[model samples]
Target chain A: MSQANEFWVVAEYKDGELQEVTLEMLGEARKLADKAGSLVGAVLMGEGVAALADPLAHYGADRVLLLDDALLAQYTTDAYTTALAELIQEQAPSLVLIGATANGKDLAPRLAARLRAGLATNCMTIKLGEGGALQMTRLDYGAQFQRTMVCSSTGTQLATIQPGVIGVGKPDTTRQAELTTVEVKLDPNKIRTKALGYLKPDPEKIDLTEADIIVSGGRGAGGPDRWPAIEELAAALGAAVGGSRVAMDLGLIPWKRMIGISGKSVAPKLYVAAGISGASHHTGGIRGAKLVIAINNDPAAPIFQSADLKVVADLREVLPATAKRLRDMAVSDEQGGQQ
Target chain B: MRIVVCAKHVLDTSIPFEIDEESKGLVEDGLVYILNPADRCAVEEAVRLKERQGSGEVIVMTLGPAPAQEVLRECLTLGADRALHLLDRAFDDSDAYSTGFALAHAIEPLECDLIFCGSQSLDEGCSQVGAVIAESLDLPQVSAVTQLELGATQGSVSLQRKLDRGGREVIECSLPAVLTIEAGINEPRYPSLPMFMEALHKEIQVVDLDALGVRSQEVGRRGALTKHIGLGPIRPRTKITYTPESDIDPIEALRLMMSGQTAPSGQQSGDILKGEPDYLAQQIIRFLQQNGMTPEANV
Candidate 1:
């Protein structure tokens, strides 16, 4: 293995498939490597998962450092951190990027502590700055403000990238990477945390990030009892439903339904903001939206300032009424076509 | 059973906060600082667990400036038995890794049976401190717990943790472990007026790096692995406002909406529209049809 500090990305995989973020991180690392005159390496750990390296290579990795061991088959905080930290120490990596998922959130900090490295959490952008320093930007104070952070020139620089922030380049089947197996010496006694089992949530839960059209309710959205109208409008538009941070904190909606900097980031072709004041935290996540429509009783709501459409009316009345109009239009269109 | 809860005094995220240009940190003037909302849940959970046993001590700890003493007192008023403030300028400019290191060092001597921390700080939202502390202390960490129940058997606990896509992981762990409580798990109870008044008089134990047996160079700016290089605003986005904020008829509003649509440039944003839901509904349907949003738009 080359002794130079390589631009490294730890691949996240599940259910015998590589997660999309892994490819996205590799793609990003490829760009950074090209600029800094460095090599890109991907650390993929699992049992009998060497085949997955092909996809990582196809995405961006120049070499795949495979750590295949039964101890790592299931993710326990202890085993994964120990194995990766050992490899990172020996390989002398300059920077490490991880996806900001649940496991990532749990793993990144421990590794940082073990390695005594710097960690920038939930970064939306990454770039190498002056003096060959790794500079990253993230929305903070609930995404209302943006700040750029720099990692030290000393030890390994570490960061966790938010999902969907980095673009995944088109894969080239012709691309290939060198696969090198790294031995994982894990003692079963050191593993204290055990996975009891996963309890699946409702199968019908919608992923707000991937929705083409999204209808979100916010501060003015009274409660679950008042949510039906919003739901009705979403159904009429065939869009996924979401709620704002205030709605989720008030227990009017589930946490996963929250649409804000603290929650999920979404980019839909059409977005309808119902009873929302459009605070920067909520608006920050929707920057990628193509078209925005705002509905509120108060015409002075901040949402109207940037929305494509503005409504100065009560959402409770407008939502269901709009849904009814949509259905009626569809029905009448069918009749008009027959004529 | 003895339980220790880690709390933070952070800027109230409900209000707007500005960054200090010189220090590259928060400008602390005119801003209300409260115990982190998420940490409040952890403190509440610790108090409730103590109350259930009818006999246990809840100790709250924090690593921050002297003003952080107030947060420890707040925890006390909320029913905690003791408070410890890890105060030192030597700990400044510490990131999640260094911050957790100092906290773990302070907590090691307490020899508590359980440790509680908020899943993430409201201001930073790193979601790493509790896990980092666990790692430093060589204990198992269960994070972002929504539902927690202490078993009748000593040293046994059950929890439901948040997973990706709204799923949950059922976890069963033993005592002497670290748990990061999720927000909205349980309603945090406010202290009574008398309790609040009493908390003011209670003494807050202040400890520095020397007291914690950690060297100054290990946690201060000198020891930090991450540094702030730049501060700036986000990418500028376009903004337009509707004038004469009067409620208009549904058809006119729909016309305005269509006119203002995501035009390339130079086109005006539509007028503000307000009308009865019944009438607005009709106009919206027509608008969708014209915009190709309805099912039969292609036709």
Candidate 2:
């Protein structure tokens, strides 16, 4: 295994930090490359990202290529694509892996097109098959079925891996790699897209995937009045608030807070359901939770069948009571600790 | 100005799916179809641009079998001026690469000033064709555009792209580019009765690989750069065990649970509280108070 015969992971940087997906991809790439009897390399871009190469090597990259330039600091399609596509051409690696972030999604297809290469986007898994052919598995039709794609043997294989699906490899501080800087000649006039500024969302909103505990509401939550109670419970329990697909579809909540087959899949420590009927689609998402406690008006609601604890009570009453209970318990625990 | 919106007629994913015994792919028989939700957003955006300009032609296009004409017709009813249907059996099993190749070739002669597409179709969710077509046509593209504003002359597109990391990036690009729209860009309007009727009789220009000057080998699965290998089940990482306490009083169970007292072994069916509302409420309060989950009231 050598640099020319290695699999490449395109390192992604944001807010002066290497994105976790980039490390996760490197770990995955290491596995595939090892299976193929190849090595792993990484491509880093941005004005001051050269130092980011060491961590990439620790994660698994055997070699790191840096394109540090002021023009490359912020990601614009043309400049990055031109530079990366050129590198791919020069290196002609067997496979290239990129994170399926907004930037990666925009970059992968364009690069694939330039090289006439096969691309698989939002892949959950990648493996090396017989004769070292690249195989990828991705969710299709909103996870209704999994499609395994085999990259064509013609050119370099490209794939954008979904974030959070692959586990990050433990960093080996002892590992080191050779770092190389590549020069890119970018014509300012050829750059068609100009980024103006970034707009940040309200910081209070929690991403469901990152939450350890979740309090979710569904159609059975009644209406907007019950939403506050759900939020209150979540706050008391130090949990994030989520909604079922019906709650989101009816405009009761935003799409990002939705959880189900078509929405974000979560594996929280504790998943407390309020007034949810528990459609199979919803259950499909929460099956990974460590524990499921469901409260609904109907004892026989489908959610009960899947729950470890089933409480048949009106959510409007049970939610507030549960919140009050958790709050009191926390206060007493604090008092006992002081003594 | 000419705006072309690429619409996809996809199998309704909400329903059940079965693998075809013969093709080993999705079963097509008895399957319901609809315009992809994201593509609907693209069509709506195209129509809005056309209406705003009030002097441009908006064309809705799709490359699929005969049934795909329905999606184009739906777009026509949404106010697109015409439609382009790339219909042929040779178009079957096409991957995003060849599909983009075919579309880029078909659209080249049309000389479109702007091209719109859904971020990704639900069936495959690859989210690739727009960028591929843009690359094939050598145009710059913006993907997952949530907000779009055209310059006064419609020469450039200023867009806000939603990032996965808690913010949005505003980017400006020259026209004659591709823009793939996500949902929430616009609410697609329902077709009025008169417009719906007019759209049915409207002509759709159908083209095949021969007509589009694409070689047969370069249009379908033969033209694809990737192939579907097989399918497998998505396994859950954790398993749930029940803690049945239906026989125990809820208050007792709550006290036992909070005290970290172990329930007897072989616990299975979980707790099921049943009583009148007032009684249940009182019992719950007692349980909470005993578990130190509620404040000690005027007992």
Candidate 3:
């Protein structure tokens, strides 16, 4: 058994449910906690968040500390950090794991600075090494190299893990955990910026991070044309649609849907590359995909090197045909089920 | 108003990198260095802000070895009014946290109203320094800022921050805040020949760890929160099996092509079919039929 007795995972809730990354963190945290002989604690902060303790427990949390208040209905840096840092100081867990979301990124650094703790950001893999030290692997230099970091022994080890990189454990309905409410006093004066509101993109489109499969187009797709061919394949496969930097730069796709070092890093179950040359920049984003299938006219495209399946054909013709085949396959599966 | 922009000189990434056997880091000898791409955007934003004000100075500040002076020089040529280099051997092993601590100390005494930094360094992509510095200096920070609007007269700045999942957040913060600029915010103007020549002779003020009032113990490996335990190439994807286009029926060939499963062992590359388009399409259909995936397969 390890010397540390506590492991903490910060829970993030949005749109009235626990974010996917929170569950993933709990899943990984449970393993590390078992290794260290430590109890896994979930720190949930937000208004009306006490009810989230059950889901966290189902994901393997042994205890839940909820800091629910009206002031925290929306995330403001000062309030959340103050409450969280205070709880961390009190609990003094050996390690804290946070999801590398926008709010999580902003909060982790501020909390680390306030607590003077060592922080590893954007870690893809984490393990508890000998002597209870947290070992973390993260991508650096624009995904050119992976660096493994070991936290110092002096203070609490903190890390922000990227979303979609880690797998979530199956929920256990019979799991039980203790929930405690902690009161926090937030000074409204400390909040320098008020979240006036939020602006969203087209809601009909699936989020890249949440999608299991992705169909990405590049400059080779020849000017987007609303990316109908790519969309057809995505619709057929039930995958999200994405684009490369060139396609995004040309205003053919939204910049937020870009897959590369600078944009969102996604790890889908299956990735379809259409008309992309597979430059290191674009390929790096697809590194975590379980399987890659490339469709490009250029046989020399670098993307072919990384793909498990290659179709060297013009996407305009191949995409429509492929989509039809997949649709037909689905129909046959239904018919077989009926028989 | 004085705007301070943080710049970094990084090894050019387009060229292949060779690791130094002795240090386990990039080999410095014979390697080309350039201003980090995103830092160039930060400099551009600072220069644009200076030009808009028409009276303020934009100072470029950086922390690195002597070779990094080239980055500061480039900023000068690009229209910065002055340069500051925090140079010290002790910082060679510093991580993002310690570096930010030293930088915050260095900038605390300077007269500044706003600070800008590239959201990340291309060499490390840690993205911790700017936020850490902001925390140390007790200032609000907004990162990944793509659109910036400065209300100079109102002592506030409103900006649009990019999100990874497809949206933007509009945030407004008071002046004297830190903003980490992302790429593509503005097209960086190229330095003209005359401007380049004029900036060649400008002096960059150099300060060491002691001069900046930062103790040597507070930097380098000793002060670092995290230590690099290992560095190596990223693991490549699993090998693929290639099927030759001429060996089988086109439909059968295409079915095997669409399947993402690994091919028989010992096949390093996948099949390459060089055939007529009509034939290839038929092969795909045949493969689908063999797999019982087509409606006809049910018959």
Q: Best candidate per DockQ, number?
A: 1
Error of 2 at B274 (Å): 30
* TM-score of every prediction relative to native: 0.73, 0.75, 0.74
Q: Candidate 3: what is its chain A TM-score?
A: 0.66
Ranking by DockQ: 1, 2, 3
- Model 2: TM-score for chain B: 0.77
Strongest candidate by TM-score = 2
Candidate with better lDDT, 1 vs 2: 2
Model 1 docking grade: acceptable
lDDT of 2 by residue, B8-69 (tens): 99888899878765565776678888999999999889888878878898888899989899
- Higher-TM-score candidate among 1 and 2? 2
Name the candidate that leads on lDDT.
2
How many angstroms is residue A65 displaced in model 1 relative to the true structure, after the best TM-score fit? 1.6
Candidate 1 local lDDT, residue A79:
91
Ranking by lDDT: 2, 1, 3
Question: Which portion of correct inter-chain contacts appears in model 2?
Answer: 0.56
Tens digit of per-residue lDDT, candidate 1, span A32-140: 9899888899999989999999999998899999999999987877899999999999988888999988788888988887887788889877888887888888777
Higher-ranked by TM-score: 2 or 3: 2
